[model samples]
Target: MKYTRILTVGALMASLAACSAGPAGKAELCESFDQLGTQLLSGNGIGNPLFRAADSLGDVAERYSAQNLGSDAKSLHAIADSDGTDSNELRNATMNIAKICGHPLGLG
Candidate 1:
């Protein structure tokens, strides 16, 4: 009985982790952008750097989406092309986009 209980708990935990690890939903993505916008407007100024980064990321995302390769290896290559030339700016921009677009698409 003790072993059975432990096994059951382990299975439950594994299932929960798998569910949470799924891709971001549309709602989550929207919420991420909304939260970033709110932070920018809240006068923290910290959000300025992130906002600029997000803008760049948005441009990249748009371009990738246009080519229908936003989620493909081609997109990564594009990111590498952009980043390899300007490591600092590329890092900052990608970070901002991740923050703002980290959530699912329609979250907000």
Candidate 2:
């Protein structure tokens, strides 16, 4: 029984570690930004419900090792979280991260 508990605890810790291991590389971060861009750059942009869920993106950004990446993500997420966030600001924030990730996202 004690061994079982230890194994379970070990498994949980491993899962947590894996979850915390942010993007594998710049490519991964760019992919994440791409998803956000799709939702944000849409006609609805901030009006969309998915835009509200963008706050979790910062958690991933924070886990990234790059210097400006996290801050850029923070700016995007911060603007996203703001009550009066505008589409232009959102576009700019997304562009900043996209530029850093080398995957510039253009709006449709």
Cα distance off (Å), candidate 1, residue 78: 20
Q: TM-score each candidate.
A: 0.35, 0.60
Tens digits of per-residue lDDT for model 1, 31-100: 5445534544443354344344344334344443223324422333454344222334433433434444
For residues 9-84, write the lDDT of model 2, one tens digit per residue.
9999999989768554565666666676676556444455545535545555666566556666677677656666
Clashing pairs in 2: none
Q: How accurate is candidate 2 locally (lDDT)?
A: 0.62
Alpha-carbon RMSD of each model: 9.7, 4.2
lDDT of 2 at 23: 51
Candidate that scores best on TM-score:
2
How many residue pairs collide in each prediction? Answer: 15, 0
State residue 63's C-alpha deviation in candidate 2, in Å: 2.7
How does candidate 2 fare on TM-score? 0.60
